[model samples]
Target: MAGGARASSSSARREVAFRRATEADAYELARRMFLSGERVDMQALATELGISRATLHRWVQTREALLDRVLGDLADEYFTRARRAATGAPDDVIVAVAEGVARATIASGAISGFVRREPELALRLMLRDDASVRRVLVGRLRGVLQDVLPDEAEGLEGFAAATVQLGLLLVWPTLVAGDEPSGERVAEICRALLAGARAGELSGGR
Candidate 1:
C-alpha cells in the first residue's frame, strides 16, 4: 500500500508538470508563428512543437482561441508602448499615438500576411463585436482618450467610439481589399476626429 501511494503521488506530480510545460510551449510557439507573418497550421505546429495534435488541442482548445489570445497580447504590447511614448498636449499626444499605431500596422509583416492569408477570418476577428482583439484595442484606445480629454469627460465615450470607427475605416481597405495601409491616412482621420471632438466640447458638449 505504501509503495502504491508513492507511485500515485509521483504520477500526479508528473501530470501537473506536463500541463504547465504544455501551456508555456503552446503559447510561445503560437506567438512566434504570429510574429513571423505565418498562419498557424495546427498539424504543422504540433509537429514543430514535437507534441501530438491532441496535446496541442488540449493546451489551446481551438485555433481561433489561440489566435485571439496571441493577437490580444500583441495589441496590448503595442498600445502599452505607444502610450508610454506619448507626450505633448492632449490632442498632440493622441495624434502621435494614432500615428504610431498606423506606422506599426504598416510595418508589421505579420499583420499584413495574416490579412492576406485569411482575409475573412481577419475581418471577422477585427470587426466582430465579440472579438477579443477588437475589444482590447477599443478598450485601450478609449481609456487613453478618456484620460486625455478631461474637459470633454461627459462626451469622451462617444468620442472614443467615433475614434474607433475612424480606425476601422482607415484599416478597412487593407483588411478587405488587400491595399497597403497608409499611416498618413490614419493620422489625417484621427486628427479630424480629435478636432471635431474638441469642437463639440467647446460648443457646450454638443
Candidate 2:
C-alpha cells in the first residue's frame, strides 16, 4: 500500500495548490505574478484562477489598472518599512525614509525588470497625472512631513512633492541607462532642501 499512500499524498498536494490559486483574488494573484518578475498576463491569470476573462476584466478593468494597484501596494509597503526603520531628528528621519525607499526600489528585481522590459509603458503609468502609485507615495511622505514639520504646514505639500521628484530623478539613471542609482545622493539633496526650508529660504522667510 506504499504506492497507494504516495499517490494520495501527491493528490493532496495538488489539491492544496489548486485551492490556494482559486482562493486568491484577482489583485492578489496579479501582485504575486508581478513580484515574481512575471509579466502579468490577464488571460494566463484567469486560466490559473479558473475564472473567465470576462470576470477578470470586470475585476481589474485593464492591465494598466491592475499594474497600478500592484505598484501602489509595493510602494506603500516599502514606504511603511522605511518609515519604521528610520530614526533621527525629524528632518533626518524624513531624509532617511526617502533614501530607504529609493534604495529599496532600485534594488527590487521585479521593479527594475519591469522597467527594463517595458520602459514606455512603465513611464506612462508612473508619470501620468493622477497615477495612484505616485499619489500613494506622495501621500505617505506628506503625512510624515505634516507630523514632523507642522510649523511649515503651508509648504509641506510642496516639500513632499519635491522629495518624490528628487527620488524619481535619482532612480531615473537606473531605469533608463541600466546604471546604478544612488540613495546617498538622494539623502544629501533632501537634507539640503530641508535645511533651506527650515531656514525659510524656500518660502520667503515663512
Candidate 3:
C-alpha cells in the first residue's frame, strides 16, 4: 500500500507539471505572436491553444494584461543581458548596464515595429505610470543598485525610479518624433545622476 501511495504521488506531481506547462505554453504562444508583430487576439490564441476563450481569459485576464506580462518579460531579458555584460566600478557598471539595455531596446525590430504600427497604444501602454513593463524595468534597476550600494538602501528605490524616468524621457523623442535614441546619452545622464545622488547621500541626504 505504501508503494502504491508513492506511485500515486509521483503521478499526481507529473499531472501538476503538465498543467503548469500548458499554462506556460499559453504565455509562450502569446509572446511569440507579439514578437512576430501579430496582434494578440484572445479568440485566435484560444483556437491555437485548443482551449476555450474562457480558459484563456482565466489564464491571462485580458489582452492588455497579457501584453503587459510579455513586455515585462522582454524588458527583464534586456536587463539580464546588460547586467551580465557590464564591467567596471559599481557606478560605471550601473551606467553601462543602463546604456546596454537602452541601446538594445532602441535597436529592437520587434519593439520598433510595434511602436510604428500602433504608436498611440504602444506609447500609452509603455508610458503609463502603472505599466507592468515600467515596473519591471525599475525593479531590475533597483535590485542592481541595492546589490552594488547596500549602504544606500534608503535612497535606492527613488534613484532607480528616477533613472528609469530619465531613460524613458530620452527614448520619447525616438517614438514620437522619429528621432534617433542615443544610449550613450542615457549613460552620460545616468552617470551624472549617480554621482549627484552619491554626493547628496554622503552629505547626510541634504
Candidate 4:
C-alpha cells in the first residue's frame, strides 16, 4: 500500500510538472511573437524544451491546443482587467460581463491569428468536445457568473457560448483576414447583445 501510494504521488507530480512545462513553452512562444512580431513553431518549442517532438506533440495534440493552453491560463487577469474597464449601469455586473467579453475578444486575437493561419488549429481549439480552451472558458465564466447573476445564471452557459461566437466574429476580420477593428464597434455589439438578454428578447435556454 505504501509503495502504491508513493508511486501514485510521484505520477501525480510528474503530470503536474509536464503540464506546467507545456504551459511555459507555449507562453514563451507567445511572448516571442508578442515582442518580436514573429511566428511560433511548436516543433522548435519541443526541441527547445529538450523533449521529443512526439512527446510534445502528444502533450499539445494540436497546434491550437498548445496555444489555447497558453492563453487559457490568462483568464484571471483578463477577467479583472475587463471588470475594471467596464462602463454602464445596472448592478455593475452587466457592464462587467460585457467588458469581460470584449476584453476576451481582444486578448484572444493572437491565438485567433494562429487559427486563422492554420484552420486545423482553430478546429482543435473550438470544435472538439474536450477542447481545453472551451472547457476552461466555460468553467471560468460559470464560476464568476454563478453568484453575481444567479437570477440570470441559468442562461449564463448559453450567454457565455454566445460571447465566444460573437468574439470570434468580432475578431474574424482581423484574426482571419488581418483587418483591424475598433473597441467601440466591439462594445456596441456587446451592448446590443446584453440589451437583448436583459430585455428578454433572446429566449429559449431560460
Candidate 3: misplaced stretches above 4 Å? 1-21, 201-206
- The number of clashing residue pairs in each candidate reads 0, 0, 0, 0
Please list all clashing residue pairs in model 4, or write none if there are none: none
In lDDT terms, how accurate is model 2?
0.76
Candidate 1 local lDDT, 75-160, one digit each (tens): 77877887889899988888777777767766767777788888777777766666676677778777787788866666555555
Candidate 2, which segments miss by more than 4 Å at Cα?
A: 1-24, 199-206
What lDDT is obtained when candidate 4 is compared to the true structure?
Answer: 0.55
Instruction: State the lDDT of candidate 3 residue by residue for 125-199, as single tens digits.
Output: 777888777888888887888887788756544567777777977885476667779999999988887877766
Q: What C-alpha lDDT do the candidate models reach, one value each?
A: 0.70, 0.76, 0.76, 0.55
Q: Give all TM-scores, in the order shown.
A: 0.77, 0.83, 0.80, 0.61
The candidate scoring highest on TM-score is 2
Looking at model 2, residue 165 earns an lDDT score of 65
Q: Model 1: residues >4 Å from true position, as ranges?
A: 1-20, 198-206
Question: What's the TM for model 3?
Answer: 0.80
Better of 3 and 4 by TM-score: 3
Clashing pairs in 2: none
Residue pairs with clashing backbones, model 3: none
Q: How would you encode candidate 4's per-residue C-alpha lDDT over 47-139 as one tens digit per residue?
A: 545577787777667655556665455544566566666554543554465556555655554555565567556555554556554555556
Candidate 2 lDDT, 107-191, residue by residue in tens: 8888888888888778776776567767888889878887777777565446666667667766854576788889998898888
